[model samples]
Target: MEGQVVMGLQKLRVMIGSTTAIGLRALARLPHGTRLIGLAASYPVIERWLRALLCVYQPFPDIETATKYIRRFIPAGHEHSDVVSQLKQFADVTRESDYPVLFYLSGYAPGLSRVFDLGGGIGNLFYPYDRELRLPATLRWMVHDLPDKEEIVLQFAQSRHENRIGFSRRMEDASGVDLFIVSGALHYFEDELAVILARLAELPRLVVVNRTPFSRADPIVTTQVGDGYVHACKLHSLAATIAGMEAVGYRLVARWPVHERASRVPLRPDLNDTYWGLFFVLEADRRRRDASL
Candidate 1:
């Protein structure tokens, strides 16, 4: 009897999902359907219903609006103790997507001295990468994240007796750094890669953007809800990101898919996409050195 009930519930779930998809598709065919849906999305009641049904909320026009919505739930982001604790588990674990970053870091290790890890939580990648690649003795890795994370990161580093890893609250500290890494955190911000780098007095010669969600469709801001936490993320345009980096004198060295992470917007199957990792280097700097050679 219990086994029958379990199978029945699974069937029911599939039935409901299929029904919802069909209904949404049909509704989209009506005149002014898209406009009506957009207006309905603004209602808090609808938002709650969507959240309950799909585990995703309304698709905001931009990240700022989505961020405002999430703030009502989680004001401090990773600063929340539970979020931090959950993130700490990945400190020493490496994923398949990490190898690409490791490959590039290996090649750059000899000449690399400084690394700015934007939005890196508790120096997660530092420990695992160090274990695998045996980082340079003099390397200085700065983790740029929330001010509240500084203490937690410090404690973790101290416990591990990791002297090379440090914390910073300023993004400008990345100016003229040897390398800048953004792993699993770029979508949360509003700025493009070029815009962020342009603000720095000097750009890092090498940059790695890993575990980021990108879509071929137009940009969409969606909320990601996990156990006890919610975050606003914008699915960036793949072409626009690469073009923006190129316009700023950078070249795409390598790109790879990250199968472990993905994003799916409710009722928008067209916007569904997987995460990716990218590596970029300054073309002008390379050209200068080649010319000198």
Candidate 2:
């Protein structure tokens, strides 16, 4: 009788939690609703409910099973293939046609003798350009990515026998780089991006960010499921991103829409479906003016 009563109480708690979650999810679709949902559906409440429901049938001695199950709902970082496939797709497109990056590069190439490609996967930008056109013999390109991706990028570079391309896991490797190119990757850094941007002792002459999703609405961080993995991505505010750059003595030089693709933030589809690109140049005059102040 005692065991049955405990089981009944567990079921009741699960039912209540499930209903709350469902309603919160629905509320998330309405304007100005996400904040409310974020508050009500706190991680603990959701985790507790998931645990009770998932463990009731077959209990596991190890906690790993539960952690794995819960993480499916949350965003973890991604592995090589998750990023490689998307980069390869972009590379293939670049090979066949003139893309915006190439257009921008043409205008700046004379001045850009060195480049740091942040979050560059398997040298996607370098490989295609190297094969299609002759890069400046004096140009040096470095790719910075997660540690796990270094080996794969090295192999890809070796396959092409491209000596100009180098790989590193450290951001310090980007020091003194003439150009900083962050393509299709900044959103992953989200709030952390500001910290990284601020840490640069000597800013690059130019910074180009491409395929970044932005919105007029408030910034949001959400989980994105891609290539069978869950990753955290942020949809930033265009104004805010520009402000951030300006804060660091960079001026917005150009802006455009990707047009090729859009990213929808699940519940707020209307707000963040479109992606944008931007270019910023260091304002030496402005920096000197600020220093004088």
Candidate 3:
């Protein structure tokens, strides 16, 4: 498929370059399953990821609270870094939390996960997220991924959260749902980009973009989405993207660096470098439609 090929080419470069984010725009009129070959572009180094990683590695954000989110970290891949383990622990928590009733909304990532990951990926980072913060049995969760990535997410979603997933009718009106999560969604889109936001704008109390960036403090964190075969590609800045998110209803609620300690097999102790982790949660004020309305 064109999508697969494009992504493969992109990955090939990331294996050698600085940043990577999956994306491909499709027209509303395009027929289902139509493949669009993404001509490859030249790879470029964007040190944003590198700098962020180093900063967190040195003077890391306070991880005590992220510990409350012990459900995000898990079988942290590569070096079993604190961040990876914490994420895994976090996912494990989500698997057990009572915050169910998924407001399964979605959109494309702006090729950068600043505020959060908008759509799920087969990228399989959940393994680490689960190890960092284990999914809580006390919460009900909704997994958001693209249709192409659904079957896999569904398989995982069912194995963990089971049946409690959806924007339960009147849930927004129930004063407020415990938590509205975007978990691993929010990297494949741009500003004002969706039918999903308009809906989420009218529902859910809290939105946690578990996997995106938030760097308003700087303005140089941009990366080129290079094609494997093309000579060049456009560069996208992470700072600009977060600004767009604020423009919409989403406001920055909380942000912290994800970190974890070194470990054993349950943890991958071979981490090569510290990951530059950032997470942001957005809130939406929905209308309260009564049963009689």
| Candidate lDDT (C-alpha), each | 0.77, 0.63, 0.31
- Can you rank all candidates by TM-score, best first? 1, 2, 3
- Tens digit of per-residue lDDT, candidate 3, span 1-293: 99778756645544433321211112211453112211121112323433233221111122332222221211122122342334434544433211221212222111112222234343233443434444343334333444444454455545664543322222223223333444333322332222234434243334454433323232212221222211111112244444554544455543433233111110111111111222233443423322211
Residue-by-residue lDDT tens digits, candidate 1, 1-293: 99778757644643454455446546655786545655665797885565445322546778877777656534445566677876788886887899999988787877788999998988888988888888888999999987887888889999999899999889989988889999999998877777788777777889999999987677778776655456888888878888888877789999998999777665554666789999999876532211110
State the lDDT at 277 in candidate 1.
94
On residues 1-293, what C-alpha lDDT tens digit does candidate 2 reach at each position? Answer: 99778757655654553454355446666786876534433576764554354332112223344335425333344573656667656655563223666666666776567889898877788866655555777778888887777887777778767678788777876665778888877876656343566666566777888877776667766544443344556667778788878877788888878876666543344455567778888887542222210
TM-scores for candidates 1 onward, in order: 0.78, 0.69, 0.35
Q: lDDT of candidate 1?
A: 0.77
Is 1 or 3 the stronger prediction by TM-score?
1
Q: Count the backbone clashes (under 3 Å) in each candidate.
A: 0, 0, 107
Residue 8 lDDT (model 3):
68
In angstroms, give how far residue 146 of model 3 lies from its true place: 1.8
Query: Candidate 1 has which clashing residue pairs, if any?
Result: none
TM-score of candidate 3 versus the correct structure, residues matched by position: 0.35
Instruction: Flag regions of model 1 displaced more than 4 Å.
Output: 1-56, 73-76, 286-293
